[model samples]
Target: MFATRSEAGDRLAAELEGRGVEADVVLGIPRGALPVARPVADALEADLDVVVARKLGAPNNPELALGAVASDGSVWYNDALIDRLDVSDDYLEEIRAEEAQNAREKADRYRDSPGLPDLEGERVLVVDDGVATGATATACLRQVRAADADYVGLAVPVGSPQSVADLEAEADEVIALETPENFRAVGQFYREFGQVTDEEAIAYLEGLGGRS
Candidate 1:
């Protein structure tokens, strides 16, 4: 198991460098992704920024992600799960609007300007501690694409094999240190998984949030 998010980030940076992966900017999904994205930005010599997406919880199960929606309205829905749950379209619409606002507020807290930077014609990488359902990542990638980034990708320390495979459709490239068959959750691969505070997460932005 990876020792910590920082260690995982370091290892992830190494893997990217070995494969000649490069980025003009690196964005970490706030709260948990900041620690991991810090090392990656330092290693890549890329500007550090934040991307925000909030998971739409399943009915009566807030922990379960039905999908995720980004601050800019970019979203991804787990059709299979929604169908299985028989979630109504009205509920989905309401929840998506609620979560989108939450994501925007989060991005605002971390960034002075809030939202994405000017990524048009630039290569961008989205870093996360790990992936479970990939709902958030998909939304984040869509947001990046909407910004007209020349290339958009995702990198993680570990992820569920199925989720990693599924994300291939969202990003130009998907990189993960591990995609174990036995993957139960993102925390299982991290030896030092802990919640990152908003204050702590903002520090990683390095005042490089976004440029006008």
Candidate 2:
């Protein structure tokens, strides 16, 4: 296993090199993704940026993500989960509005623009620390697609096998370091699995020294 996020990102960048799909830019799913994406951007000699996605929580349990909303007002819902929870359509819309605003706020805090970078006719690699249900990743992918990227790829250090499969349908290419069968949570693979703060995320991006 990789020692840290930077190491994981470097290995992932090497994999991307092998595929011959050189990225024009690397987009991280903050705040957990920033550290990983920083190194990938450095390795690729490209710009590092954030693609903010706010979790759309269920009515009572705010931690339970029903879906995710992007900075550009794009929302992706877990239809199966919504059906299972019996969430009302009106309630979903309300939550989406709040989450969209939250994403925008976070984006503003992290960068001048929280939206996807210009991937027009460029290869774009979306990096996340890891994937769980991929609700947020789906939302991010939708935003990337909206930018009309010529190529779309996802690179993560580890992910649930099921989540990896789900993402493959959305991205043109998927490069994950490890896909464990007994996947529990993204944190299980990391020793330093702490939440990354907004300041830390922005500083990490700035330290990479270009396109920040």
Candidate 3:
């Protein structure tokens, strides 16, 4: 297991290099993935930025994600799960609008600006600390696609095998260091899985300047 998120980032960077993956830019999911994405962007000599997406949790069970909405209102839903839960269109629309605005606000906070990078025709690599259900990551991928990214890849330290498999259909490529069959959670794979503060996450992005 990795000692910390920074260590995980280092190893992930090396793995991407070893695989000869090239990216024009690296977009980290805010609050957790920025630290990991920083090193990868540095290693790849690519621009670093944030790609924000919020999970649309169930009505009663907020932890259970029905889908996710990105900053740009791009969405990815688990149709089978939503159908099984009998979630109404009105409810879905409500949550989507709420989460999309939340994502946009978070992205603005992280970037410290209202402007977003031009992603059209760029090779974008979306990074996260790890993937659990992949609902948010799927939304992030859809957002990147909506931005007209020529190629979109996902990079993570570890993830569940099933989640990785599901994400393969969303991303043009997936680079995960470990995909354990017995995966319980993303934190379980890290020895020091402390919460990353907003300040710290934004600092990583600030260090990248306007490269993105």
Q: Give each model a TM-score.
A: 0.95, 0.92, 0.95
* Candidate 3 local lDDT, 4-26, one digit each (tens): 88888899999999999999999
Segments in model 3 whose C-alpha atoms lie over 4 Å from true places: 208-212
Candidate 1's residue-wise lDDT over 1-212, tens digit each? 89888888889999999999999999999878888898889889999998899999999999999999999999999899999999999999999999999999888887778668899999999999999989999999999999999999999999999999999999999999999999998998877787877767776677432110
Q: In angstroms, how far off is 55's CA in candidate 2? A: 1.4
Report the alpha-carbon TM-score of model 1 versus the true structure.
0.95
Clash pairs of candidate 3?
A: none
- RMSDs, each prediction? 3.6, 2.6, 2.9
Question: 1-212, model 2: which lDDT tens digit per residue?
Answer: 66666667777778766776678878899888888898788778878888888889888898889999898888888899999999999999998998898888888887775456578987888999999988899889888888998888889999989989999998998889899998899878776676777778888889742222
Poorly placed runs, candidate 2 (over 4 Å) = 208-212
Give Cα distance to truth, residue 69, candidate 3, Å.
0.4
Report the poorest 10 consecutive residues by lDDT, candidate 3.
Answer: 203-212
Looking at model 2, residue 56 earns an lDDT score of: 90
